[model samples]
Target chain A: MDLTTIVILALTGVLLLLSVIKDRRKTLAALRVAYKGFVRLLPSILAIILVVGLIIGFVPPKWIAQVIGKNSGALGVAIASLLGAVLFIPVIIAFPLARSMLDMGAGIMATAAFITTLTMVGFVFLPLEIKELGKRFAVARNALSFLAAVAIAVVIGVIIR
Target chain B: MNEKADAVANGKKRSMRERIRWDYTILFLLIPAFVALVVVFPDKGATARHVAWEYFKEMAMILPAVFIIMGLVSVWVEREFIVRFLGEGSGVKGVVLSFILGSIPMGPLYVAFPLAAVLLKKGAKVANIIIFLSAWACIKLPAELMEFQFLGWKFTLVRYLATLVVVVALSEVIGRVFFKQGYEVPDEALDGAEG
Candidate 1:
């Protein structure tokens, strides 16, 4: 496993250890809650995975690049951010796809915007987010996040270039 | 609402079988759709499985720990504590605390959703929770490291600083405009999944 996995595993182990030591009963209750909660959230989680698979399988990366790469100014940034907001591709995959775009003449700002929005604004998780945190909070966070992605891209563009 | 609380307190609530049927239905429908996609495009189907499998392995490894910690929050953490630390009057310290709480975890954004929900229920500020979710989503330490390795330090650092500034501003605007009245987690919305 990677560092993230190892670090989180260690932390969770310690927390579980402490809880068991301090109060076994409460810890058991906590485990029960964990179990029930996992079951409750399992469905949407799987749906997201399936959807991600489908998108990756169907939508060619070359096509996505052509949408943003075909332009270089505001239109490029806007298209990049919009695509980022909609796509559910994982960050690991996103990085390589981004590198390919850069090699093919995509601007740094557009790439930055795409990555930021893809990470920050998850359209795939909207239903789950809304269910857990309310419609207003979910909608507001996403809508603002879209704008923020472009703003950050502009800042980075100005600074880097 | 009181009865639900009582059910939780008693730890004897009935199985949430009915409430979860929608999820099962979605899963049922998705399986066939995916199968059809795979059958139509065999080569792309392999790529799809490869992408999904990588993430599935990551989820399988981390989710139990993440869920356990979430459960611990439900049982061990007090609502008053969340309020005092992350609520409206918490100031700059609240934002810092939210960032710390968010960055230390290792999971996809979706995993954080339930935790954020729990914190929201317990009285964390909407701004603070948004900050937490934002950090979890993008500014994660490992994520930045990955960026550095793939895109180089110059690109990584510039984008990192930019994202941090924008995340804070975005979260605050969302907080002020939408949750100015203090958003409440409606009881039925979080019905079966309090943990």
Candidate 2:
């Protein structure tokens, strides 16, 4: 396993041990919860993986670079931000997809914008957000996040590039 | 009274089951579509499958552990504990705590919504709750590690620092503009909201 995976596994192992020691019953309950959550999340996770595979397999790197490459400029950032907002890919898969995009010559700014908006603004969850947090809070947070995402992308583009 | 409560609980359970069924349906449909793509364009399909397999392997390595950690957090971290530290009058300390709490990898952002709502109902400051939600969404520790692995240190660090600052500032702005009169969370509004 890679260093990240190893670290995570080790951390989980140690924590599990400690938790079990502290309270075996609670630890068992935690494991059950974990199993249930994994089962629930499995389909979406698999779908996302397949989607990423398809993108890499079918979509030419040249085309991706053309759309979001260094020369794509402000328009590219906006497109990336919009895609990030609309798409529902989990953050774990998003990083790998983004890495592939960068390797294919996608611009740093565009990638950053995509990642930022992907996480911060969830179009699919908008109604739920509004229901829970109220329309005003939800609307303001999302709108501002979209704006902030673009701005952050521009700033990162300047600094890194 | 007991019968009414039981009916409401059963209704909630049914809806939850329905949602899971819909998710499975979408997954099943996508699988065939993917297989069809492979049939149509053998070479590209193979490549896609290969890439998908690589990602699947990577995710399989850590996702279970991540979920277990989440489950632990859910069971261990008391709602009252979250409220006591992040509630009203928490001030700067509350904001910092919120960010730290949020940065810990637990679950998906949707799972955080109800928790945020609970904090709101318990009188957590608007800015802090916003920061908590934003951090939970964008800057979780596991996500950052993945970002670092894929994007490298400079990119990861810059984006993390930049997002942190922006989220905090944005949260303050959102709080001021939307909750100028003190945020009032409606009781019972989050009844059907899934965590």
Candidate 3:
């Protein structure tokens, strides 16, 4: 297991033990809740995973680089931002992809924009977000995040370059 | 009155059931689509499966633990406690606490949304909740570590600071814009806002 995975497992183990010690009933209740929540989220999680698989499988890294390469400039940043907003790749995978893009001559600004937007904006989960957190809150947060991403990208570009 | 309440409750339950059913249908369709991809383009299909497997393994390990923690938090932490910590008038302390709580490694952004909703239901300030959600989404500790590993310390650190500043500002602005002063949002506001 990776360090993050191991750490999370250890933390969960410790917490679960403490909860069990504190109150067996509550601990069991917590587990039940967790199981229900897990089941509820299962389908969406599977769909997202499948979509990520399709994306990585179909879209070659070389192609990503060519589109967002150094010469692509402002347009590259915009494209990267849009793709990041739409795509739902895990951060673990996204970092490596960003690094690869950088190595392949993608501008630092474009890479930053991609990473920022990918995390901050979630087109795929919009329906869920809207359902949970009010439409106004969800839409406002997402729109603001997109704008913040662009601004962050510009600032990063200026500072790093 | 009792009969009306029961009807409303039943309607809510039916809607929830329908949502779940829709999710199941999507998953069922995706399975066949996945098979077709594998059959049509053997090379890309295999690669896709490999990538999917990697993610599935990761999710399997982390998601349960994350949900359990979430469950514990939801059950053990009283609504009053959350309100006391993150509610209106909590001010800068609440903002800082939200960031710290959110930065802890959890599963994914979608998971955080439910937790954020819970916080909102507990009367957490909108600005703080927004900051919490944004921090959970992007400024997570493990994600930052990964970024540092791949993109170097300078790039990671700069972006992290920038994101923090921007999110806090954005959240405050959004809160101000969406929620006017002296406006008391009812407890049922969120439920009523749903389509």
Best by TM-score: 1
Give the clashing residue pairs of candidate 2, or none. Answer: none
Please write out the lDDT profile of model 1 over residues A54-157, one tens digit for every residue.
88878889988877777768888888998999997777778877877777778889988999899989898897787667788899889878888889899988
Off by over 4 Å in 3: A103-105, A127-136, B140-146, B149-153, B179-195
Summarize candidate 1's per-residue lDDT along B1-195 as a digit string, tens digits.
999899885653343455467678888899999888888889999888877777778877888887888878878888888889998888899999998888874768987876887788888989899889988888777667778878889988888777777888878888888789888875544443343
* Interface Cα RMSD of candidate 3: 4.2
- Evaluate every candidate with DockQ and list the scores: 0.64, 0.47, 0.56
Q: Write the per-residue lDDT of candidate 3 for residues A1-161, one digit (tens) a residue.
A: 88778887898899899999999988887787677767766787888778778888988766766677755489998999998898777788889999889888888999999989998898877866765566778888899889989989998999998
Per TM-score, what order, best first? 1, 3, 2
What is the Cα-based lDDT of residue B57 in candidate 2? Answer: 86
Task: Write candidate 2's Cα lDDT for B31-92 as tens digits.
Answer: 99899998899999998898889878877887788767756765666757656788666778
Candidate 2 stretches greater than 4 Å from native: A69-74, A84-115, A118-144, A154-161, B98-161, B173-195
Question: How does each model score on TM-score?
Answer: 0.88, 0.68, 0.85
Clashes of each: 0, 0, 0
Tens-digit lDDT track of model 3 for B45-147? 9999998999899889988887777667756778777778898888899999999988987667876775676567667888888889888888877677888
Off by over 4 Å in 1: B1-21, B188-195
Fnat per candidate: 0.71, 0.69, 0.68
